[model samples]
Target: MLAKSIDRLPPPRAGGWRYEPKFDGYRALATIQTDSSVQVHSRRGTPLDDAFPELVGALYAYLPAGTVVDGEIVCWAGGRLDFNRLQRRYAQRRHARELAVTQPVHLVVFDVLETAQDGDLRRRPLRERRAVLERLFRRIPARSPLTLAMQTSDPAVAEEWFDTMAVAGVEGLVIKPANSPYVCGARVWLKYKSRQTTDAVVGGVTGSLHRPAALLLGRYGSDTGRLHYAGRTTHLSDAQAAAVAPLLVAAIGGHPWPVRLTVN
Candidate 1:
């Protein structure tokens, strides 16, 4: 099945519809045509065939040639999705063997991009796509490498998963408009980042020597007027970070360094 692209932020359907927890992981696009040839692409439209051989093999075995799927590639470790580990395997030289031993890849399929003999379904409603998805999932084997993305209409359940992930050191939660059509290259999907609350001193800012952007974060210090290397927060504007940095430096005067706290 060849998946077609759609706008991400389409209006919701009237009957209301299904809802699924968005995973904080790599957005993967899998395409397997009738000839059994398989292609995997990242959200950025980059090819990822060489990085994950086991995943490719799994897709080849379970999905019919020309089956196209839209999903997230995730690696779960110690009750959390280990994105760092997933990234590591992508760069490993012996990824196949290493992935088998270390962090294994799993496809959390959520949408059916293409359906057999039906022609392009990109512009169709999500319910239509989901019908194809449900049918396609019934045939494929459910195992580690290939599995359906968990779905729940209950806000409580979704909230629980979000809390569990946050406590477990996972990235964050993704919330998608259930009946909304798939949109390519748009922020139609909403992402809620896991905020790590910490107090730190304002650092310095610098203009982008090469680009138009500016930096807005710096290290932390103690009341004793000591300088400590705290993490940077680029969340502020260049003007904001630059404005407060000087005052912060002078307010503390000259003091000795204190203990530091490092977050994962």
Candidate 2:
């Protein structure tokens, strides 16, 4: 199921609402075949088995055949979910096993879409589906890559996660109706992300150094104080470009950044 973007979280008075931490990772749907083989793919139908062979191996060992699950593939590092490391894991698919040993990934299973006995559970209400999911997790070891995601109906607990989970790189909260059924590709659930303001350094500009069109922003790493590309600014006004151009100082020796950096 997909979540619709919402400006704010559900009100405290909202009834029958369930809250989950919006994870900072890749959304994946996985299925276990009758022979205990597993197939995993992203929402866009891209194959993910190569990127996370360890996850597939763990799922094959834990889940029963004819089971389908919906979740995110997340990598935890430095006591938090590191999105950069997750990207690296995906990029280094040829050396996935080595990466897994250094920075293992987890499958945060949230919803049980199907089971061995029940062919399909997407039409069932979430409350019942959650019960089935819990039962399945009972036999799986805690250290397994597949883990049940955290869900709570209490608004206070949800608020606590919303306020604090961001430090661990959690995107935000996803709110769903307790009795709502899974609707594929539908924006039935609501998502709210916490907004924060911060400072960034102007590493470079696009278009030209003299007549820049947009700003390339960077932030100094906390440990090394080395500038890392954070993001780019939106299109600049003529006056904004003209005023900022003079501040652009050329890198004396070899620049820290590469000549060609992937924009996205």
Candidate 3:
């Protein structure tokens, strides 16, 4: 399932929502076949087995056959989540074993899709699926590479985690409805990312107005009447692009930086 971005965490209410910290790493699905063979891949269908052999090895050892799971592949370094190391692990697949001893990767699972006891849980409520995932983890060794993602229904606890986890590269909270079933590609869940309010003008954009890739921000010197290039944003998600596309307007003639900003 996917999530739509929101500004803030809503106050607790009846049929309260739950929260999971958003890890800054590769989102992947891990599946163990009936024969105990394992496969892990990203949502885009890119196979990750070669990139993270040790993680796959751990999954094969800990997870039972007929089980499928979804989670992020993260690595830690110097007491914080190290995304660069995570990327290197993906790139140097052949050296995975050597690096696995130095910089081991981890799979922080959040949802259980299929279990040995229950064939499929995608159609089940998230609460039920979570319970199943927790039970499955009970048999895993404490030092196992497979770690369950933290979750809580309490807003206060969520807020506290949102504050503390940011230091560990957790970007934000993924708010989920307890009763919602897993619906692939659906934006039923809401995500609240950590951001500071800043004021800047949309001086330009990378993509077309109807399908903007990212905003090129700028600020004008009041007396000089000059547009100073501020900064480009991270690539916009589909939801963000959709929301901003309609609000964008093409720049007219005499455009600043008209030569096309490119690194030589």
Candidate 4:
């Protein structure tokens, strides 16, 4: 299941909704066969066992056979989820074993897709599925790499988590209806991410004077004191583009970005 990005979190109603931390890591699905063999798949359906051997071993050792789980694979570094470290493991296969021992990845399980006895749980309500997931976690031995993602129904509590838990590598919060069934490939779930605005210097522009394109942005580094490329904004309206054209004359001397602006 996937979540649709929303500008804001919906207000809590009498009917109920579940909120959970959105982890910043690779979205992975783990399937444990009846013979205790484990296979992990990435969001794009690529095999992940080769890059995440530790996770495969832990799932095979702890979770019972015929278990299918939906979760995120995250690497913790300096008390936060380090995506760069995880990407390094994925790209550099030769040193994966050493990195697995030193950095150790964790599978933050959020949903149970299937169980050994009950079979597929996607049709079950989220409340019921969560209960089963919690019970499954309780059966795991101590110090296992598998972790159950925290959840709550209170929007206030969810906001507090969003505000405070970002330091712990929480990307945002996922909101789902309590009684809704898990709809695969459906945008039933909503995601809320904290956002803030910052000022960036306009380095260049695309398009012509009559119709302006995006604004190439830059920012001055505090240590380097140099204008570094930040990013580009979306296309501008014709009127807005014409209004800003007079202000964006080409620099006579050396500019921060010397390359030509290519519009796409």
* lDDT of all predictions: 0.65, 0.90, 0.89, 0.87
Q: Which candidate is the best by TM-score?
A: 4
Candidate 3 lDDT, tens digit per residue, 1-264?
Answer: 998999888766666798999888899999999999899999999999988888889898888899999999999988888999899888998887888888899999999999889988999999999999999999998798889999999889899988888887788999999988998899988999987567898977878788889888888878888897888888999899999988887677777766587521
Give per-residue CA lDDT, model 1, range 164-203, as digits (tens). 7676655555555556676666565555555667655534
RMSD of 3: 4.6
Ranking by TM-score: 4, 2, 3, 1
Question: Per-residue CA lDDT of candidate 2, range 89-134, in tens?
Answer: 9999999888777889999999999998877999998888999999
Query: In model 4, where do residues sit more than 4 Å from their true spots?
Result: 205-216, 221-226, 230-254, 260-264
How many pairs collide in each candidate, listed in order? 10, 0, 0, 0
Look at candidate 3 and tell me the lDDT of residue 84. 91
Best model number under lDDT: 2
How many clashing pairs does model 2 include?
Answer: 0
| lDDT of candidate model 2 versus the reference | 0.90
Mark the 10 consecutive residues where model 4 has the least summed lDDT: 255-264
Indicate whether candidate 2 or candidate 4 has the larger lDDT: 2
Question: What TM-score does each of the candidates earn?
Answer: 0.73, 0.79, 0.78, 0.84
Ranking by lDDT: 2, 3, 4, 1
The whole-model C-alpha lDDT of candidate 1 against the native structure comes to 0.65
Clashing pairs for model 4 are: none
lDDT of the structure predicted as candidate 4? 0.87
